[model samples]
Target: MKREMKEQLRQVFDTPDTRRKEEFLQNFNYPKATYREFLFRQIGYIRKRVWGLSLVLILSAFAVCKIMKDNDATYSMVWVISSLFPLLALLASTEIARSSSFRMSELEMTTRFNLGEVLLMRMGILGLTNAFVFGIVLFSVAFKINYGCLQLGLYLSVPYLISCLGSLILMNKISSREVVYCCAGVSCFVSVFNGILANSKPMIYSDKFVFFWIVLFILLCIAIVNQGSKLIKKTEALQWN
Candidate 1:
């Protein structure tokens, strides 16, 4: 019985098809094999277009602010909104790039490639892109405000990061176009709510409110991570080419 079992094990191990599949999997597991160069290329193509539009919006907002200043109502609400726009734009662009890449991968599913690596690369690229854009906007805003650089940076960075967290969460679930529309809607709603709240007398400026906001932001980050993980899992399960 022992000899018979040993022969069966050897047969299984020496099977040509099994050996070929193992070799194929070894090659497929290579980092370069799963890197998704097309996604990076797409991101590069979109970079110039995104920056051009952003520049136009910034210039227009500056011009409008200059006009408003002459009339003594000069704080550019437009610029403030623009600061938040990067978070939305980055998320939308990344989603588009990722979706295209995933579609291509689905087509390439027969190749010995892992989807998880592609997802990680996408997320890394998105994070880096947003960080660069966020830094530029923070510098511009600080210069415009003529405030102490440190103080202005703090205010701008925190909210921008918060928005980035929100963007990541939203992108995980929506298409690029849907992200754009949802951001627009959320911005409008937040603006209205803030306007109303600002005009009202504050009954609470307590530590509890500060703590509450912190907790909420933390929850948002957690949600973003969870959603991103789900997206990665779903894409993997779909076994996209």
Candidate 2:
């Protein structure tokens, strides 16, 4: 079996066709990984490791929602979700920054696995899990209060995106605790702004507000994605303190 593998490898190296040689080299350089396979591998690891955090966040969100006795709760849900879920998700994001915090960055850099992909996988799991939790709370709230599906989704999305942007911005600049504090402050401020926006002179009820916010969301999304990619690179090159 070893001899056969060696002979095949030799044939590939000795191939006269440049296209075949290049194809062989490309195959050797990059392993095949489909989106589905990655979800099961990297995402699966995150699910098992992070289940405790996810459970706490969901329970807390549900408990908070349950405490609101009033049907017309005066923007309570908005403030809670905007302030809490995004902050929790942002805190979860710092898990990937542990390599820098614990001074394991050098070892992490030496690993054969793709650090960027690992970073992204962790972020995606945290983000999606909180999003689902928040969505359930919002959907339950909508049963008691007045909020359209569009409004619920967009309002929840804005602060989450902002949280992600802030996390990506600070992932390399400070320790994980600092990231949580800074992001919590930001989320609180945005939550207050959301409450004010919803209660006083609400623009969501106005025509084209959805369209405008959608455009704004898309623009912010582009920024988040760009910054997030750069943050991954920064994570890989993080300096030990």
Candidate 3:
């Protein structure tokens, strides 16, 4: 009797729609495969674009190194920090919006893994790429420039978080592709503004405000991650409405 009940349940789920729904629930995975393929694809995309990022960093580093070698002034470090990071932030923002840049949104949305998981995974990939670049710049600065770790860190962190967090928030008001341009523009503006401020007033952030920026960074990260899930759901739900 139990065997007969099992057979009936199997037959009920034998239809094409049920199978597709099950596959979707399994996150675009075959019974034998995992999401590693998806991850690798994202890695390759970053690798393909590595040249642009490298050029920006290399040129800035060369200029900074040449200028510093000529003079012992510590103020040169301010210009280096200000110039490189905001452009990196702009590039990172473009990476975050790659899906929209390619017009692959509808296809990505309906995949077996669905839009939410794909978005979260892609953003994770971009984050790692940015981290790699960040580390390189920090290492170079440590050897070549005379700046406090906290000061350089705040320069990178503040612009990066501002661009990413601002992009996520703008999704409500603009198309994702448009948000990329908006983020890039804002980052450019910030880069110039920061450059001016850094030169005029080196080390704008004091030791007392260090804890405040740290807390703000943590909150922004949490908000960005949480919004990924919400954005995906909202995107899909809009189709039905």
Can you write out model 3's per-residue Cα lDDT over 1-241, one digit (the tens) per residue? 9999999999987766445776686686444426897777656766455547656775676667667767975466646565667677666666656667668777766554666676667668767767787777666666665547765666556766766666666654566467777877777777777677767876565566667768877887798776665666656653421
Question: Candidate 1 overall Cα lDDT vs. reference?
Answer: 0.52
Off by over 4 Å in 3: 1-33, 203-216, 226-233, 236-241
Clashes (candidate 3): 0
Q: Tell me the spans in candidate 1 whose CA falls farther than 4 Å from its real position.
A: 1-42, 45-48, 57-79, 82-87, 90-105, 108-114, 144-184, 187-223
Model 2 TM-score is 0.66
How accurate locally is residue 184 in candidate 2, as Cα lDDT from 0 to 100? 58
lDDT score of model 3?
0.67
lDDT of each: 0.52, 0.66, 0.67
Residue 188 of model 3, lDDT score: 77
Tens digit of per-residue lDDT, candidate 2, span 130-205: 6677677677756754768777677667777776676667775775456656665665666666667667755564
lDDT tens digits by residue: candidate 1, 28-130: 7444533457566535735565556656655654665456556654234323544455444444444434454344555444544545555555566656765
Q: Local error of candidate 2 at 186, Å?
A: 3.4
Better of 1 and 3 by lDDT: 3
